[model samples]
Target: MNKLLKYLLATILAVSFINCTDNFEDINTDPNGISNQSLTQMNNHIGGSFTPMFLNVFNVTPAWNYQLQQGLLGDVYSGYMTPPTPFAGNVNNMTYALVDGWNGFPWSDAYGSVMPFVLDIKNAVELGNDPSGDKFVYLANIIKVSAMHRVSDIYGPIRYTKFDDFTTTGEYDSQETAYNAFFNDLGAAIDGLKSFESDSQFVPFDMSSLGGDIAMWRKYANSLRLRLAMRVVNVNPTLAKTQGEKSLSSDAGLLETQDMYINTGFAHPITVISGSWGDVRMGAEMESILEGFGDGREEKYFNPASDPALNGVFKGIRMGIEIEAKGQYGNHSSIGSVIDGETMQWMTAAEVHFLMAEAALRGWSGAGNVKAHYEAGIRTSFSQHSVSGVDAYLLDNTSTPKDFVDAINPINNIAYPSDVKIAYNNTGTNEEQLEQIITQKWIAMFPDGQEAWSEFRRTGYPRIYPVMINNSGGTIDTNIQIRRINFVSNEINTNSTNVNTAISYLNGPDNGGTRLWWDIPGSNF
Candidate 1:
């Protein structure tokens, strides 16, 4: 962490020096620069730094950055959306070739845009010696956990817990250590925010849909705690149960009424990728479940195909297939108007209901009826999208996912793997109910592929199709699929010693096939 921080600071200084003339006074006196005194006038330094952390969590700029951050990896792997373009001549992330060049964006975006701003807020509060500023620190920590958890989930070990300590070398926390830190940080944030529930200081600088409401922020934090709690249930059930009960009983409560969306004043990246560039389209798994169930949300999520051969049906491309050109599947469904707005959704109330449903299935205290929660998840998702016919949709026990048929290439088609139905079966086994909870959660989450991909790897629910092509040179298994992405090249190149130590923390070799700490290989029970 120290080395990376020094390198970033040095680069900034180098760029500033390059633009300077011979006059030191002229170079030092930039009229447009905001002074430290001015920053302290209204805590601009603390509040302004939060915007980047919010935006970079999903990255709403340049569009391609978001494409690499999650669209290319989780969006495809979660069976949500797949790119029509066969980048690198068909040797790319979809086929398990694992492009090092594109895979570094998630890592770099966090360290560059998120971590630095967090450190700035902490430093500003501490340097001012203002105990009243603790509210700002608490808010910053909540945002930090929200951002860094995604980074850790993607690459397993990341530079967290000791990021501010410049004395230590660039050491990385193993995924387990990082998760424990995430839990502790979230717990502390939830507690510290209770007194500031009425504080209105955050409103002017609030960029999220919460609108600087401290009460809502605390609720979001509690909901996030439950999410992280459920993520570790498979590997450490006792700890998971403890944390899950804590979040459920907390007075802060979870996100129950509305979704958490970051108002990143840019067009949704899906619009650019699927609508403008034609690089992305619906996934085969999405087609199977949505179309087969006759779900009303399908019309809100995607448009019918434009190709005359398919006759304007909602179609998608199978991942890891042989495609010589994009034109073959370019006419497949594009993203619909649901995400045409300026905000990027982070977490939803529907997701929290599904989480509660899973917690109840695990028999955690304070987790109410499982069937009720499951049904509420479906209703909440339909309500969020303003879709009708959820009553009929939830009762349909007969419809299962349909087999996928690639209209462009017949060889890429595959059968739907699971027979899981739409209706919740109370008499079914625990595993069966768990699958029902997760599969509905998957559909309710819609375009958030990062969390969806993580859930799929953790629970093995909502059976997705395996890749038709394997280009990993045996580093990845076709059946096991890609478990985790390898560490990026930037870390290996700049921080070789620490990156090597981080690789040893993984369960297997640091490749796409290696499982993270929470991705256990056995039954859900």
Candidate 2:
């Protein structure tokens, strides 16, 4: 096949999943064909592409629309919510189920769907010169690391042996190898910084909105490497520490992604462009944590007006007690709530700052003000969510947070205000850092429902109400949150061997109660 033919074929398979309900027998003809377009045009489409991808994958669609954020329903976050009452068996517990076998979701959409064009962009970059190629490479690395981290986090391992393969006999690789490849990609990305020396070539890469900016992409790559390394600390400490240290040692400038998140409006999912509607909202687990902190972002993330009150409210349902109707979508008075994609975000400066703060806390030596990063995270979180500052917020509090600072007890009192630095002085050990992190992350993840769930599951700090109604699986602990989402129905049929093997590692049926590799313990009633 000719070069054009190969690109065309690859493009076909890529869009095949875009979904066409009608006679789409052969309609996948590269709606955004980049091979014929220049590097600039290609980057245009990719510039803000990640916003929808991240929001969609996490299940943070507009709840008013009934669109589900895949990860939202996952047992990680809102699994705490039940049926006619709140959380039910139908909810997804991603850590256990969504990552492996057959449930790996649209989270990897960036990896499989958006990434292929990166290869084409590379060709375009090579065809051009100066900032074009360099900027593309850097952005490619940023996207690459982001996607790989998602894959590694879920499956624990993947086939990175021969990436972007179109041939036979190329199977999946181990997670460790995938991490190594991630490091290599980071190195390549870091090298793109020099490409910015020639003044950004806006012709082939117009980052004025998002892409033409290579310098920012470089920081994103480094920071992302830090995140991936930190993530693998348990699985590969030596590698994690080394990579963390390496990224820290570098002078590859650090810019928060929040400074430039995807604020796309009137686009598909959010708009009628794709002719699609999505609804994802703040999970009860998340809302509880934020409310506890009196987080300012909750106003942005959650609707202040009670849609359920207007309509009928469906709280929680029994998991497996054989219940009939869980509840209706909008059983309250009205039929609408805001689930539109108007508020979607990709990466944010706040996230970058938070990651830096985490790196500082973990002692990942790098060019950053750990305290400033910490404060940045807090302030940016407020700014991101349009939250009020600490003072005004505290005034709204019934009592100063400082009053309760020393009153609470954590699993690790040492990790409290003393060692964590950020926790120091502001609120003594009793302040609940777990809630703080989740509260901030929840805001930063505006329109990102799934990530909110992930943070909630990893910490298990917030106490939550079981459910207004229950579903069929079983009862969720009033205190202990749900563990994992059940393996999807399809996996049991196709990848039964791996599915069964994975189940053996799980405590129960790999349902909402099963835990993932990283989650801490919880009461699975």
Q: Return the TM-score for candidate 2, rounded to 2 decimals.
A: 0.64
Residues 434-506, candidate 2: write the lDDT tens digits.
3444345445654444444555555542333333223323534433556544544554576566556556654
Name the lDDT value of residue 480 in candidate 2: 54
RMSD of each: 5.1, 9.2
lDDT of 1: 0.88
lDDT of 1 by residue, 169-227 (tens): 37999999999999999999899989999889888667788999999999999999999
The 10-residue segment of model 1 with minimum total lDDT is: 13-22
Please tell me which predicted candidate would have the highest TM-score against the true structure.
1
Clashes of each: 1, 70
